[model samples]
Target: MPLPNILRYLHREQRFLAVFVVGAALVAGFVKLAGEMQEGDTQALDIAILKALRLPEDPSQLIGPSWLHSAATDLTALGGVTVLTLVSILAVAFLLLLGRFRQALFTAIATGGGAMLSTFLKGLFARPRPEVVPHLVEVTSMSFPSGHSLNSAIIYLTIAVMISRSFEDRKSRIFTITVAALLVLAIGCTRVILGVHFPSDVLGGWTLGAAWALGVGLLAATLQRKHKIEEPDGSIADQSSGPAPDQIGS
Candidate 1:
């Protein structure tokens, strides 16, 4: 093979190695956190963070301005089940309209599986909602790993990875993934601010959700490479310029 081709192969191998390492680290971190929670070792830190987000004079009020409170509430709703479901449906429909049936199916399966995994983890831990501070939002479910944080991270990150596959440039792909990550962070923070979950819960959700998204993306890329699944059509962008679509993973 040519020198350029060998260099390209090495770069691809490095990128895959980096992604696999990150996913593995995230899984390990989540497992450690979960173990600490079970041992009641994280309760002190969780209480401290929750209290610090609230006023000493009034635990009911958050530390920030009233407008920030309202904004958090609105932003947090984006992670709710109804909104996520609608977004998933729209994404699937859009892909189907473009004749990307396999991609649509993959997206559907990823999102659905993530949701089920979130529910299963919550039930398995059976952790209760935070009571260190009064909850600003009404919640009635177990909360070791925040549902909102986990679900939003999975859905948004998965979609972002899929969408980024259409972009042939490194900058565009990085920007797309960065935006999705920020949105996921914002949603997770809102859960803590609203006093509905411990800080650890949000952390666990983020780590596991990110790991799940990365895992599924790697799987899809492997399947595509083996000719078992179709590559994205790159219909979202003009591919007349920039690098080849296969240079980036799905």
Candidate 2:
């Protein structure tokens, strides 16, 4: 088949089509956001949002009760290295046990690639963390793209998409994807609320992270179409009909 026809067929799938549109928007938005941040155009907005969580009397302290602080801290940890790593490992292990080695590898690559990309972008911008309010958590890195926010989005969304693809029902796929999106958003919001990241930093992280996941997903879909990567029932298909011969469809 022609490349265009293949793409058209892929686009006809509602999920992949929605992801492509969202992914393109995110990439473009990330570029524009990075440019504006570089020029220091977002200082006022950042400060305003950062300070919104603080009391009027003491700018250094957060306005919420003590429990809220603890809650934010706990929620933000969901995006931390330890938590994300554990989730990824468990997911990869489950897939491996299911004999879905290709899917497992792709999941690892998408997450690992997102982390590397986030680090590179942070260094490229070399933006500092917010000093307008006292940070609730320790951080030691350039802060244009929030590592937590980026990695959380990358890890959760990538895993969600992978798992959702295994299901044969539309509602199940949508539910899983929606939950992942909410978790990603909550994690990003906690970073900003805790005064560790500016709103723009979180925004940039989300944009790039989501785009990266979707890009990887589309690649996997393409491979699946070409029979290089197997579908959800590939294992059963293999058992019943021997291994599928690798071939590109016309």
Task: Identify the leading candidate in terms of lDDT.
Answer: 1
TM-score of model 1 (CA atoms): 0.90
lDDT of each: 0.86, 0.83
Error of 1 at 82 (Å): 0.5
- CA lDDT, candidate 2, residue 155: 91
Model 2 residue 247 lDDT?
29
Taking all chains together, each candidate's TM-score versus the true structure is: 0.90, 0.87
Top TM-score hit: 1
Model 2 agreement with the true structure over 60-133: per-residue lDDT tens digits: 67887878888888999999989999999998898888788877887888777877787788889999889988
lDDT of 1 at 101: 73
The runs of at least 3 residues in candidate 2 whose Cα sits more than 4 Å from the true structure, single-residue gaps closed, are 1-18, 236-250
Location of the lowest summed lDDT over 10 successive residues in candidate 2:
241-250
Worst 10 residues of 1 by lDDT: 234-243
Q: Look at candidate 2 and give me any clashing residue pairs.
A: none
